[model samples]
Target: MKIFKKSDIILIFAVLFVAGIIFAISSLEKGPPVAHIIVGGEEYKAVNLVDIPEKQVFILETHPETIIVCEKGCAYFSSAGCPDKICVKTGRLTKKGDTAVCLPAGVVLTIEGGEYDAVTY
Candidate 1:
């Protein structure tokens, strides 16, 4: 058997490293492309969240005291008479399974879909 040179070993490792990174990036790009926004038990279907326009806002009126505005995958309690602004502090939600809840206002924001056919839990 022939002896392996140091340069050959280094070259092999570099190629393996680049291959791993390419695999990871491709896998990340192949997942589902839907975001589910739920407010007061109602679900809104949004596709390709990154493509949402900056100024396009959605208003959700769950109750007289609860009003939410969602624009570009970010949601906040624009107007709420609730005692706590917990929902507002929850910040923007973009990933699947993320949620924001306002107990007093009875509103819930959630993201769904990940190797599952339907949204549950």
Candidate 2:
């Protein structure tokens, strides 16, 4: 049996258009500049990616040091002691609230005050 009528379809379209507008407006807004580094599930450090004029790297104190690279308002795993190197492959995180993790090394990097957070749905 047909469930949606003509008016129902138009209403759905209108709702979707409004939602699209809201999403776009929110996406265009800026977010916090801070980035946080966690090692062994603990708060390790916080940094402002925007403040660094040049590229920087850090070695986390893990079983083997975890190397992280910060550049151009983004951070990524340039290299890691983890055997799989999966974290290194996670790629760049530029937007606020972006995250990269190395479970084997107990390391996590997340952008603070990101524009959007993970939604359960």
Candidate 3:
């Protein structure tokens, strides 16, 4: 008896073809890179990271204050009043889809646009 069947091979090829199409469309939709800040599950602010004349810092006065710093083509959580400070440890976010979150303060910073890339845990 054969372990592989013709129908199974055709199904796999069809699935791969659809996945490739979806990936191509998604990649073509990206635009200039920008950083969006969300606080308390709401959009708080957005910063264009494509062109920065100088380093800029933003302070969010939440339950526990948080700080964001942006330089040319990169942004990061520089400080957080949270006890763990995990957000600050996330380091600079220079590529599309990068993110940093401070759970205690309900603050999230994410980079969007430029180009599409594979996601990682």
Candidate 4:
């Protein structure tokens, strides 16, 4: 007859628990790659998100008459001659769903995320 000790079972469980914790920590350490898109009448792909500095000022020059300044992860239409200037009031956008639309200049800014190799494909 084979006998199993309580200490042995506890040791096995503890080892498994520690392994699980380690795996979870490693997975959490991985972050999603960033993406950037310049939205106009159609979606125009921009350079990788890494190219854009975070929490910094950026100027986006569009055709016609419009300029955008992105700061602190949010971009707003700072200057525009559009009749409505609605894009200016749209304010800054930060999250993935956030967007800035410049109707007059026919420009838009959007952010998206997907599995990327950090290299242009």
For all predictions, the C-alpha RMSD in Å is: 12.7, 8.8, 7.6, 14.3
Better of 1 and 3 by TM-score: 3
Which stretches of model 1 miss by more than 4 angstroms?
Answer: 1-35, 44-48, 114-121
The TM-score values for the models, in the order shown, are: 0.50, 0.66, 0.70, 0.47
Q: Kindly list the per-residue Cα lDDT of model 4 for residues 1-121, writing each as its tens digit.
A: 4576888899999999999997565444322333244646655544344456654433545655666665433455676777887877887654454566776577876544432344564
Best by lDDT: 3
Give the per-residue lDDT digits (tens) of candidate 3, residues 1-121.
7877999899999999999997666546577678889999999888887667898899999879999998878899999899999999999997676889999999999987865343345
Assess each prediction's global lDDT (C-alpha) against the native: 0.59, 0.78, 0.85, 0.57
**What are the per-residue Cα lDDT tens digits for candidate 1 across 5-120?**
88889999999999999756544443333455465567654544444566444465555465555565444556666677787777766555566787775677655433232334
| Highest-scoring model, TM-score | 3
Q: How far is candidate 3 from the true structure (C-alpha RMSD, Å)?
A: 7.6
Q: Give candidate 2 misplaced runs (Cα > 4 Å).
A: 1-30, 115-121
lDDT string for model 2 (1-121, tens) is: 6799899999999999999997666456565556788987778888777668898788877875688888757888888887888888988887764689898888998876554443244
Ranking by TM-score: 3, 2, 1, 4
Model 3 vs. true fold: TM: 0.70
Clashes of 4: 0
